[model samples]
Target chain A: MKKLVLRLRDLPPSAWIFFAWLVTLSVLPFLIILAMSFAVRSESGLISWTFTLANYERAFHLVYLKVLAKTIFLSLGATITCLLVGFPVAYYLARATPEKRQMGLMLLFIPFWTNFILRIYGIVSIFGNHGLLNQTIMRLGLTDSPIEILYTRFGIYLGLVYNYLPFLVVPIFSALEKFDLSLREAAMDLGANRWQTFTRVLLPNVREGIAIGSLFVFIPMMGEYVIPDILGGAKEVFLGRVMVEQFFTMQDWPFGSALASVLSMGLMIAVWVRMRFEQRKAGPTSHGLR
Target chain B: MGDQRILKVLLNGMLAIILIGGAGFWFARKSNDSAQPVLRICAWSNYLPQNVLTQFQKQTGIRVELSFVSSNEELFAKLKAGATGFDLIQPSDYMSRQMIRLGMLRELDHGQLKNLGNLMEDVRSPAWDPGLKYTVPFSWGTTGLVINTAKVPLSPGEIPGWGMLFESPDPKRTSLLDDMREVFSAMLIWKGSTPNERNHQKLEETLAGLRNIRENILMFTSEPRQYLARSELNISHAYSMDALQAAEMKPEFKYFIPREGAVRWADNFAIPTSAKHVAEAYRFLDFILDAKVASELALKGHFSTQNQPAWDLLPEAEKNNPVLYPDQATKARLYYLEDLGDLLVLMNRMWAELKI
Candidate 1:
């Protein structure tokens, strides 16, 4: 025990300090949330000291399960949409001259610098029933009636895609920027066509970047309450909204914590799956290269 | 080395400075702790004017510290989090009742509040707090509909009651309050049932009705005034104060309590059981209850005051504004929300189902 203490003290101060801070800030709060999830709520909505699995039992009910499924579906849709729309933009920016590339990246990040809620409100105004789209259409004699765009599934998709497109673009762009040009040349030299060479060479190289970008987009979208609340008109319930209602409106902290715990577990499983897939794909390729 | 000696000297100087500063801070805090009475108030933002607070501080040497909460649930949560140093808190009628039941509030000494009689008779002994034992009514308002006259040109007679919301020619332009109780109550009132109806069959009927109208609703939001102002939403279920504010921005807008009736709410001032400066809290409550001060606060907040003398002092235009002071028939129609206790779970479930 004395030797262990002395050895721990001998370690670099910065390393131990950072480890302590991480444990305190992140791990401690998570542990507390886990503990709270097992507790019971009193008649007046206060958390009781007694432990129970009733909160978790209630969380897995059919209604809540449906909400969770919808949340996952929405997030997946957003992630795929972002990847599709972001790839071409990222490709163009990556292939641009350094000066042009910097400008393109700046333009991409400019929208993000603005307040998120303000940007959402701006979207609301643009897609609203008597919004700019309908007004423009009317002025151009295209249609007499205003086009209904806001407060629909389409509106939510637009908001999610617009908000998360940059997350996908930035990571994929960086990956493309680091790509070895010789690999593409070699694929072509081996009698591969443009499409074939691109598929065989370019796609695999950027798989990690795509995975990282998809995770960045998907995780936050799964817990998104604001965009759906503002843009989708609170017509549907999502996991984030359900959790918020439980915590704030219902004042049921244990149930909210249980919902949050399940969500975190789902997220962990998703991350693990992705990591395993990446490892399996990388293993054979790395060995072949060596 | 000379550099090593300089570094040691610098470290000693820094240590001395920190120790001295820490001592000074501790001494200052200790001195201030006993110097003056500090009254901590937790309430909704803009509920009390800064000038009124300043006046109270000047008159009584008590320093006032204010914290704001957007909702009553937040107030309850703050107290439940080990009774934060809140000498006074503002809770709506139903919430006050819940807090009282939970033994979270301190019963008021009516003798300490000299101006208690200034309150209107109706609110003097409200159902939530009979005999004004736990709370004093601060501000009151009704939850109703705000219509953009430009888009919704129909006369009041043409579109009467909550039915107008569901049966509108352009239902796509209508919005409902995002609040669960308010939305459910609106639907109930439209069905010619009491807003607080608890029958399972009736609730199911209400849920079906909401689902039917779901496609027609433009959105559910608390702050639909912006949408209403922009003509994005033609009609919305909103609070009378918010509706009036929206109408002030656009003269064409109108606020009307549907013929069927609506939720009449009153926010109240109460002292928590954990309050330390009960005397200061009483003084502050009494100061705000003064007829002139009450009138000023009412005008600034743009909500009705239960102070009868304050009502008498209002301008004829404000006094005659039907939206601010509804006629007797409308008043008869208005209902107060009761604390449903365990039954709230039912309401929450129905609310979730409605949104889903």
Candidate 2:
């Protein structure tokens, strides 16, 4: 016991405090939710102590499954779009002079200075049925009628991409900043074209950034409620919205907990699969680079 | 060796400061826990006027903390999650009844409430809470249509019932309430049935009717006032107060209870069973019921007061505002939503499907 105490004391105090805080705030609540997922709901919408699998069974219904599928599809679409749009901007910022890069980065972060909901509302005012976009188009004689832009699937996708674009760009930009440009020069000297150099050398070096950026966008987009609720006009259902309704509106705590548990498990599996795939793809070449 | 000793002393001093600060916080919290009576109220946003709350606080010498909820279900969930510090809660009539049934409300002592006689004869014995045992009526309004007159250009007489909304030529120009109960009730009333139609067949018929016109709807939203003001939506199902408030801002808008029928909703103040400041809660209830205070709150909120003297105090213009005080024939058609019990789940499922 004396040795154990001495060993614990040898570690930095900050690390000990951080570990304690994480366990208390994150781990404990997650464990409690996991425990509640197996509980039963009483007639009056209260959680009962008796253990049951009914909540999990209810979570597997066709409607919930469909919602989960739709959410995944939307998340995947948003992530892919972010990656495609963010890559060029990140590359340019990385290659720019220091002052120019700093200005561009400041511009990127300026949107975040405002409240998130306020930003979404700004988008609404711009793209609403009687919004600036339609007014401009009509005045320009572009069309005879107003275009339906807000409260559509396209609108939801646009909002998600706009909000999360910075997350993707910042990571890729930082990764490119640390990238060894000599590798690209070597590929070109070896008679490889620009595309080949990019694919073979540049892509592999910044694969970590791509993975992280995808994760930053994908995970939050999966659980996104406000964007779809406001922009989608409650026309379509999303998994996060359903889970929230279960907890707040329906007051089915057991079912909500069960849904949340399943979603977390699914996200974990997805992340694990992605890591394994990236590892396998990077195996031989990554070894040579190291 | 000297530097190490200094570091040790600095760390010990930091630890001492933290300990002292934590002790101070604990002691302060303990002292505050017993110092003053605080009346914690949870109600819908803008339900109680700020002036009324301030007056109550001044008179009673008690601090009042206010929290707002968007829906009764949210309030219920908060109470269920052991939000026991709340001394007063404002729930709709049906929700109050439901809370009373669930043993979540404190029975009111009528003897302590001197202004109980101020309540109008009709509201005194509401069907939901006969004799007002557990709740007191705060404000009442009807769920109705708010139209952008500049866009739709139809008078109240020309545009008749729910059919004007359901069979709208341009369904994309109309919006409906997002609430399941309100939407379902509207459908039931449109189909010439009661809002509280409990029969499964009648509900199924209403669901089918809603499905037929579902595509016409622009959206189901709780806040259609903004859309109506912008003329993005020409017609919307809305509460009378919201409609009136929106119309006050944009004169192009007008609110009307459909000639067919509409849902009449009453919000009530009730004490929770776990209330800590019961005396303050009672005082607040009586204070708000005063004729002048009730009149002020009603005028500000743009909802009808249940106090007869308060009604009398209303200006002729406000008294004649059909939206606030509908005619007797319109009042005859208004129905309050009842607690649906087990069928609520079914209704929720049906509403979800309709949205999908």
DockQ each candidate and list the results.
0.47, 0.44
Chain B TM-score for all candidates, comma-separated: 0.88, 0.89
lDDT of 2 by residue, B6-101 (tens): 657767988999999999999997788688767899988867767777888788887788999988889998898788879999989878877887
> How does residue B96 of candidate 2 score in lDDT?
83
lDDT of 1 by residue, A1-290 (tens): 99978876665645565767889997887778789899987877788979899888888877778778888888899899999899999999999999999999999999988999999989977877677888899999999888766688777888999998998898999988888878888878888899986777888788778878888998989888999898898887778888888878788888888999999887899789978876776765751211
Q: What is the number of backbone collisions in each predicted candidate, taken in the order shown?
A: 0, 0
Root-mean-square deviation of every model: 3.9, 3.6
Worst 10 residues of 1 chain A by lDDT: A281-290
How much does candidate 1 score in TM-score? 0.90
Candidate 2, superposed: residue stretches over 4 Å from native: A1-11, A277-284, A287-290, B1-38, B57-63, B194-215, B320-322, B327-329
lDDT of 1 by residue, B1-356 (tens): 55555656766887999999999999997798699888999988767778888898999988999989877887888788786689999999889888988899999999999998999988888888899899999899999888887777866555356876787666888889988888889989888888789788998899899989998888899888888877778888898878887887788888888888999999999999999889999999999999999998888787898999988998888888877898898899899886566777667667777766
Give the Å shift of residue A190 in candidate 1: 1.2
Candidate 1 clashing pairs, residues 3+ apart or interchain = none
Q: Which ten residues in a row have the lowest lDDT in candidate 1 chain B?
A: B1-10
